[model samples]
Target: MTDPAAAQAPTTVLGASTPRTPPARLGVAVVHDLVEAIVTGEVQPGAVLPPEGVLSQTFGVSRTVIRESVKRVEEKGLLTVAQGRGTSVNEASAWNVLDPVVLSALVEHDDSLGILDELAVVRGVLEGSMANAAAGRRTAERTAALQHALDHMHETIDDFDAYSQADVDFHFTVMEQSGTRLAPTITRILFDRARESSRFVGAPAAEALRLTLEEHQAVLDAIEAGDAAGAQRAMEHHIAEAWARRRLPTARD
Candidate 1:
């Protein structure tokens, strides 16, 4: 006879219980701290981490936080855990460096690597096809968007970070203009991976940025002209030059 909502309310016994709140996440922050330490080799490979209770107390957080943090590092292949034993750091090669978080950690410590060359290889194949398709299929709106990104690149040339971001945008616009899901998806991944590696921040070697902007113009021109072959060639050449710049040997030898 009672209303369902009222009937469903808890009937508390004397001094029975209080409601519980879900634990807060100290996990992500804890994991990031450990990741930085590991990547920086402060915690050497095969080193065992302090026990969960110790870590929880040290960080003034719950054991749940410590457990979740360990789990995250394990997922990144940076650590291995065994029941009743402890967690141990893994070798650098074992980590998923392509994972954005891991890549950010790695790049924070060491910026001199050819990681961008690998990224450029993936972009070259996928983006070249996208450029060709865009040349054939681009709508006027999409072409204008691409041109706008190129213009922004020129405007931002004095700011390496801004120019790099605009460069990424220009490439992404070309992929989107292709009107294909796969190319755009791959291009996004490639750019994201490159950003994580922090490979695009420095002023590219003198003339490199200028050359890239010119190549971008070439691709835009071909796309506007509806010359599919020219667009594809221009895109391929741009990617090739990018890879070459990224792979140029250091003079430290």
Candidate 2:
């Protein structure tokens, strides 16, 4: 049986991955545009925003709209406003790492993929805990569901598109089995982010996919045997290796 300590892992996934766009709201549009600009490096940190009049005219909105929009990003620590200095972008160190807007902005608008390493680290931690939690509570049905995904992964190995899609489902199944309400949303976001940044892979054009399949099977074996720590460690090791392949490029994970 899995030890109770395995259940002690946190229920929440820390940090978030790639972003798409913010919702539609009064000031949200402004927030979206400004954040995109900053993240894309159109506006450097320490540089002042255009004058309110210029912004209002540029976005074709009233000054009040511009002010409100600017306020939202400021609240997220993406911008600083003052009596003399106007408003300026803050350093990356000052931004809120968890806000979806910030997260999306930081990741979505850039080709450089500045935050990939950080995203991988947090993803590793959350997925590790999720595997541990799932192991402690694995049911016959869940095991079969996992098995099904793995089988699909193996069968589709020669086809990158099919295999990559199955790999995503496999990960989603792992989080779903963890019995966490937030897992699906968080995992999907990460999956989307990974695709956005080209990190989600078929391990195409290389042997990367086959290696990941083996690592995933190790995770499944540990879970079936009710070894929570083993399951967690396996998942983390897979993520670390995956990261080495996705991020480093030159050195194999």
Candidate 2 Cα errors over 4 Å, as ranges: 1-30, 40-47, 80-85, 108-114, 181-187, 199-203, 248-253
lDDT against the true structure, per candidate, is 0.77, 0.77
For candidate 1, give the lDDT of residue 151.
Answer: 95
Candidate 1 vs. true structure, TM-score: 0.67
Q: How good is model 2 by TM-score?
A: 0.74
Instruction: Evaluate model 2: give its lDDT.
Output: 0.77
**Which candidate tops TM-score?**
2
Off by over 4 Å in 1: 1-25, 41-48, 57-60, 90-94, 152-165, 182-199, 204-206, 225-230, 240-253
Which residue pairs collide in model 2, if any?
19-104
